[model samples]
Target: DVILKCDAYDGFTSNNSDENDNVGNPSLQYDIGINKCWKAVGPAHKQRYLEYTDEHISVKDDPIKTSVKGNNTSNAPKVEQTNNNHPSIVAGKQLSQIQTSLFQSLPFARYLNLITSLGQPLGHHSQTRRFRPGL
Candidate 1:
């Protein structure tokens, strides 16, 4: 299990709440009952994550509201606003969107390519097609 350490008093605010659950009180601990086997659930979660990042990076067909798109693959997972605290829409997480662009544009592209090829050989991409960077 991963433990997130947050600022003492500030951690309890709604800004720091889990995206799925809006409860901000950090002291209160509860597990979200995702009733699915790990094998079935993990890939779906990973796909959603990949979709979120991809959509924000690709330039969308609009003027004022400049959004991004992925490779526009027909099977790409759709990003949903199921959570009020979704990182894509949250102020604190906006920097992550910028980071994604830099990750692709700068010298990191070679590393990303290498990592993708390595993961493919290990059958890591077998779980989810969303991991395909340009696809």
Candidate 2:
């Protein structure tokens, strides 16, 4: 529901009020979920977290090296050259979009951590992805 509400590009509003529900808070959900998987490996610790307090975020279309032609078996990699100056656009209810909206992280927030002082992981969200890799 939270992700759905945050459909506009770089637009999200938190309504943690007396009548609304803050339980769907994305940052809290993302962190505890990732940490659980991290601790499961014993050595794989989660060192990064989603920024929940941020109100707005700007996303840039940084070029990711993807094969211009799919299913390639060539020695040299061919990538599609594109103008990376454009704002990245996620259609609706996406993780990257939601994170940017809630946390106000820099475009493609690659270097961020959950700034909390909890002894252990908190609430968990069922869906997990490789948003954060290492501590």
lDDT of each: 0.29, 0.29
> How do the residues 10-121 of candidate 2 rate in per-residue lDDT, one tens digit apiece?
2233445722754553442222221111111122244443222112221121112123334435432233222322122121225545544644544323333334434333
Query: Runs in model 1 with CA error above 4 Å?
Result: 1-9, 12-26, 29-94, 115-135
Identify the runs in model 2 with alpha carbons over 4 angstroms from their true place: 1-67, 70-73, 76-93, 105-135
Residue-pair clashes per candidate, as listed?
Answer: 2, 2
* Candidate number with greatest lDDT: 2
Identify the candidate with maximal TM-score.
1
Q: Least lDDT summed over 10 consecutive residues: which range in candidate 2?
A: 33-42
Q: lDDT score, residue 5, model 2?
A: 31
Candidate 2, position 3, lDDT? 36
